[model samples]
Target: MSALWRRSDLVRATGGSAHGAWQDVSGVVIDSRAAGPGDLFVALHGPNHDAHAFVGQALAAGAAAALVDRADDHPSLAGLPVDAALLRVADTLKGLERIGVAARARSRARIAAVTGSVGKTSTKEALRHVLAARAATHASAASHNNHWGVPLSLARLPAAARYGVFELGMNHAGEIAALVATVRPHVALITTIAPAHLAFLGSIEAIADAKAEIFDGLEPGGVAVLPADSPQFERLRARAAAAGATIVTFGRSATADCRLLHAVSDLSGSDLSVRLHGRMIDLRIGTPGEHGIANALAVLATVEALGADPVQAGRSLAEVAPAAGRGARVPIRLAGGEALLIDDSYNANPVSMAAGLSVLGRASGRKIAVLGDMLELGPEADRMHAGLLEPIDRQDVDLVFTVGRHMQALHDALDAGRRGGHTASSDKMVPLLREMLRPGDTILVKGSLGSRMKVVVEALTDGEAAGVRPQAN
Candidate 1:
């Protein structure tokens, strides 16, 4: 592999001493399992385990070099008989930050940073797919958008990249500010604000402020893409204006630059039309949800902000499928026929829960919801969980199954005819849910990451024995 970093660059970027022969690597990895012959392994210390313990494993897996902070009593390489390099620094994470900063500085790529209570990963994936169609684009993989995730993505950025996309996430205040500063995005997008991390941040207003922190890292005269329909729109707009960012809005509102004209949906996807700047562009997305339309608008606005063809970006939407756990759909074979399993068990909040309910409302057949608790809701957890009662009834869902303590509120509030079952734990609902599902039933499983609701999604989609009982309308 050609040098991803020069000797001088590594020294200047990390301010660390190089003790062995060094070579440029093609890839960067933190896990020993992922390290290969031409990879740079960064040893990061965490709560569960220390990467220092895996340095030998990384080297054995054919890593070219390992970056470490602990050198004294570090395993000696004298008898290993392998040609490996060891770069020592005072602090491993800070050293990584330096490398990320260096990576951004050396590259001329136009950067876009995204943050939101929901849809951060989905929007990031959409941007990656849309942008890659027009340039040498790089983006955070999966949901890698936290403290280490942001820097690790930046550090992995290739110098030849033409565009870089990053997702920033936080459960507390001041987190997005620090991450956006590192990204220094030319275009920053806030999908929307909601009461996701209420346990840590306190109020929805505080969450809005935390999400607004993404503007602090915007490049001068850069673009701020926002959701025009969001209740926190004015707040985000004010913050963006204060940061000297040009504002562009996208939503179903009249003021939005990228305005959604209409959306027609089916099980496969949605055919949506959005007015970009002044022209109306229609696109079909392979995901099923109104949130998909909203996220696509943000992508369109962002693509235009970066001087890319919004038309091409819109075209790429045809290929944009939902990411696993976020909204990936699976088919389960049954004794009579088959059931459609919608896997949205990744994460959830009140707003996302309503959105998922709306998706269920539009299903072709019987609608069922297997909901788990929304965690980190703090004191209003019960009230927030109970708030779903209205949306559930409005959706006309045939049956509802619930898990977790907080969900008990909604289960109790639901009409007895609509109540499928309620359980203290998700595991106990597996057999009950398995027995309840019928052919043509479209089931949506969703909850916060802490809820572990994906287990039910797994049980259904893994083709378990379909000793099923039919349900009456």
Candidate 2:
């Protein structure tokens, strides 16, 4: 707790009045359960739950103090046993943002902001892994890329950090601009633009525009790492130029500064060679998928832009692993034999769905796709869902189990021989998949977060598929 945040500094940054004995804080936490000794817990009020109600719990969990808006008439204040400091503010969310801004001002870390319709979290994690090898790196934990997540991640930045990686996410326009302004990164990476939030934004072009907003907050003469192979490459390059950023491209495009020279893949992983600004580097990725290789290229571009050794970063790719729910693999012990379960149950869009299918196609076993709806896909949702049939056919998938209303279209479009089953909800589909699975089967479960496809993954892993019955809809 030496210099994370002084009591006077917190007051000045948050524009709040301090009550009780003020003290310095070593950490910042939003969840009471995560609060540790010397931590400053910010009591946030959300729609379903209120963090303010857990102030006492946070203190008991060893939080040094609590940041709350209510002081005089709050119910939680009267029950406090310990004499912990209270930083009272008008609004806790704004206070968190101010603290983030102050933290950015105090640190000299080379910052990078990442945003895209897909792969933001994965690319951010890759950057963290590659950069942390050479410097003190700080990055957003989990998918902390929204308004609250961005500020909270920044507020947690240590003053001595040499690198800071922030993921900026948005479902609509202007959101990325606002989040990136808080980060003000020296480098910005747009993984690839796809149809993610089409329900709100309407078209892929609009989504591309939304993702391009990350460049708005680029520091003067900062670097913009973009996917040269993407259809919206020129549009993104123009936007980056307008934001006064130096453009750096990565992909199979010959002109890209970081270009993929060759990629050889097997059931285990991928062996790849990349040409970074004409310097060739070879590496092995523990994860499978063409997207993984693309993510590696972005990581290399980011590390080089930050003045870190791209060669060292390239070597680190050999040890890179997927974050849970993205593409974490698990071995399922079946009665017949062990099967491979690809847990891509986190979230999905059309672009990511096809990528996951491509990975499943490479498996050294029978391929099964237990898919859920790609949510937030506006008017053309049904068409987009059914369009996945092409990838399924291309992958030579043996069976397909689909869930969610949108995915029903895909199920119906599939050849009757290949269709395992379909249901209106993931709950109903889980039991059917359990019965359908066999030895040497590689199953890929994916969908948007709203689809809750993770339950299917859980049911399989928990070995409840055989015992549980599908509930009547």
Candidate 3:
């Protein structure tokens, strides 16, 4: 691999003092355990733990260098080798930000920043997948869209990259503002506005306003890709316009610049007919559900904004598959037959939960939903949990299993026939679910990260199972 940061460039970018003779780093990582040869391990101090304690471990694991703010006299640096390649900065986090800013300033890549209540990671991945098919593309790894994740991802951008996609996430106001300023994307996309982070932002409108912060850091004459179907469309448009962005909207709304004409969804994926600036294109996305279609439209709009071939980008959607814990499907082996598992266990909200249920509703087999509590809904948490019953009934889900205290609302709301079982935690649900699942059953597992719904997914797929298949992108 080509060097991502030479010693001189690293020193200049971060304004740090080099202590040893490491010449170049091929990669950057924050975790010591993830460190590899030629990787620069940045020691970040978090509220829970000080990564400075891991610098010795990172260097011992073959890291090219370690970025640190601590002195040799510091207890954490006690075991670090004297000859260890090191970059000593006043503040490692700020140093990382400086390196990111320097990388962004030097890169020629057309960058797109995505932020929203849901689908931030999926949409970012979609953008990366399509754009990479046309050019050298760089993107934030996983859900690396926070204060440090944004800067770390930016710092990792290769100079040769033609396109860069970034996902920016936030639970409080001003978070995206800070992160976006570092990204300064040429195109800023908001997937959709939903009641995520309601505990922090309070209302859906407040959530929209927090998300609009992505526009504040747009480069000159940047494009703002928005969801026209959202109630906050006008609000987001106003914010984008105020930020001097050229607005591009996508949705089923006729006025959307990238408008959806028709969509056919199934257990596997969706076939979408879309109109982009009066040019109609048909796209087959491997990711299932209407939510996937919405993400695809946002991606197409972003492709257009980035001056890429929309047709080629749309065609690339055929290869896009859902990442694990974000809609990847796995078939589990049973004594009787095989049961399909939809693992949407990464995170959840009212919007995403309903979307998952809708996807489950499309399955041919005995449809089951193993749902956990959607966290961070604030005062309406119970009401929001109970409200899922509407979609559960509408989708005709054959059975439902719920986990967590909040999910108790949905469990109680379910009719006796539909109520499979309810548990206060995921651990309890695992055995019950494993025992109850049978052949030809399509089970959809979903919940917020805090709710630990992945336990149920792991339990189902743990033993005597077929390997996971990418069902949706």
Which structure among the candidates has the greatest TM-score?
3
lDDT (Cα atoms) of all candidates against the true structure: 0.88, 0.89, 0.92
In terms of lDDT, the best-performing candidate is 3
Candidate 1 least-lDDT 10 residues: 75-84
C-alpha lDDT (0 to 100) for residue 241 of candidate 2 = 94
- Candidate 3 per-residue C-alpha lDDT over 1-473 given as tens digits, one digit per residue, 9 for 90 to 100: 78999999999998889987699999999999999999999999999999999988998899999999846676898777688789999999999999999999999999999999889999999999999999999999999999899999999999999999999999999999999998999999999988888999999999999999999999999999999999999999999999999999999998999999999999889999999998989989999987899999999999999999999999999899988899999988777568899999999999999898889999997899999989999999999999998999899999999999999999989999999899999999876776677778899999999999888888778873333332211
**Candidate closer to the true structure by TM-score (higher is better), 2 or 3:** 3
Model 2 C-alpha lDDT per residue in residues 237-326, reported as the tens digit of each score: 999999989999999998999999999986557898998987889989877898888888899998999999999988888887876689
- Estimate the overall C-alpha local distance difference test score of candidate 3: 0.92
Q: TM-scores for all candidates?
A: 0.96, 0.96, 0.97
Candidate 1, superposed: residue stretches over 4 Å from native: 1-3, 75-84, 465-473
The pairs that clash in candidate 3 are 287-473, 321-473, 322-472, 322-473
> Between candidates 2 and 3, which one is better according to lDDT?
3
lDDT, candidate 2, at 36: 88
lDDT score, candidate 1, position 84: 53
Question: On a 0 to 1 TM-score scale, where does candidate 3 land against the true structure?
Answer: 0.97
